[model samples]
Target: MLGNLIRYLDSVVARDPAPRSRWEVLLYPGVWALFWHRIAHRLFNARLFFLARAVNHLSRFLTAIDIHPGATIGKNFFIDHGFTVIGETAHIGDNVTIYQCVTLGGSNPTNGVGGKRHPTLEDNVIVGSGAQIIGPVTVGKRARIGASAVVTEDVPEGATMIGVKARSTLVKAETYAKEFMPYGTPCKEPCEPVGSQRVDELEEQVAVLREQVAALVEANEQLARKAEKPGKPACKGV
Candidate 1:
């Protein structure tokens, strides 16, 4: 148990630069939240539903992170900061990292039966702050979800998702693909909103039109100046 705890703390230290030592990592709210969740999950599996809920509530009150007791979490899972919500059916794989304000949310069941409503995150997946992975979608291994992304569909392995209703963007640098990237996205990735190309095209057209209008105005002013001069007269049919 001590060895496992040390490894878990080491994993967090590797991912987060804020902690100076393993003891400081112990003070993190996420570690405490996970500790409570381990006990709560065991109680839930034993059919001690009320007790599991009580522990979940206590953990949430202490850590500001709401993880359902029924959620399954694997080894070295790290939640950076707090305000993260993991639904009852959510399954998190080993070494998965979730940033603050991220939600592993569920969809409303039409038949009123609750079964696998939440998302499953594969191993080494990183979710950025405020990212929402809704429904029973599977985020494949090593996929990176960008900040404020809304993902409702399964994400392909090695993909980088960004923007509202997240879409995969081209991964730059094959060598850096497997490296641990902070915030689940590379700082240089050109992640943009849907239809960003069209928006760019429209902006270019508007700029061209403005330049043409400016030139027309300058020509009109030049003609007016020439007409106003005593030496110049308006041309008429000879």
Candidate 2:
């Protein structure tokens, strides 16, 4: 048990350079949250729902991280800087790192059946701050979810998701797999290509629409002139 704890602390130290020693990692609210959650999860599985909730509430009060007692978490699961919530049915695999203010939110079943309402995060998934991965989505292995992104769909393996409604970036996951990226956002070259091209394209389309509108206005004016003059009174009106 001590060995497992050491390995867990060492993993956190490796991921975050801010910690000088394992003792510093112990002070982290995320670490303490996970600790209480372990006890709560055990009680929940034993059918002591009230005790489980008591432990969960206590942990939340102490750590500011709310992990549902029924949530299944694996080894080395780390929540950085706390303020994260994992739902009751959420399943998190080993080495899954979640940053601050993220949610593994669940959905109400349309058919009223109760099971697997929350998301399943595969191993080695990295979720950035303020990310909301909603419903019964499966975040595939090695996936990186960017900060403030809203994901309602299943993420493919090793995909780097960004933006609202979360689209995968053109940059390959292998590029990120080489090293751990802070916040799961690739802030460098190759990840960000030339922009302004989309703006230019929209401008071109607007110009084309303007020309077409102008031509239609001119045609209407010419027709109005013809109607007003009546062209020499059409056979001189007898």
What TM-score does candidate 1 get on C-alpha atoms?
Answer: 0.75
Model 2 residue 197 CA deviation (Å) reads 42
Q: Against the true structure, candidate 2 has what lDDT?
A: 0.89
Candidate 1, residue 2: how far the Cα is off, in Å:
0.6
Off by over 4 Å in 1: 172-175, 183-238
Clashes per model (N, Cα, C within 3 A): 0, 0
lDDT of 2 by residue, 88-137 (tens): 99999999899999999999899999888899999989999999999999
lDDT of 1 by residue, 1-238 (tens): 8999999998887787666679999999999999999999999999999999999999999999999999999999999998999999999999999999999999999999989999999999999999999999999998889999999999988788999889988783234666785544432323354247769999999999999999999999999998988874478674
What's the TM-score of every candidate structure? 0.75, 0.75
lDDT, candidates in the order shown: 0.90, 0.89
**Model 2 misplaced stretches (Cα beyond 4 Å):** 179-238
- Pairs that clash in candidate 1: none
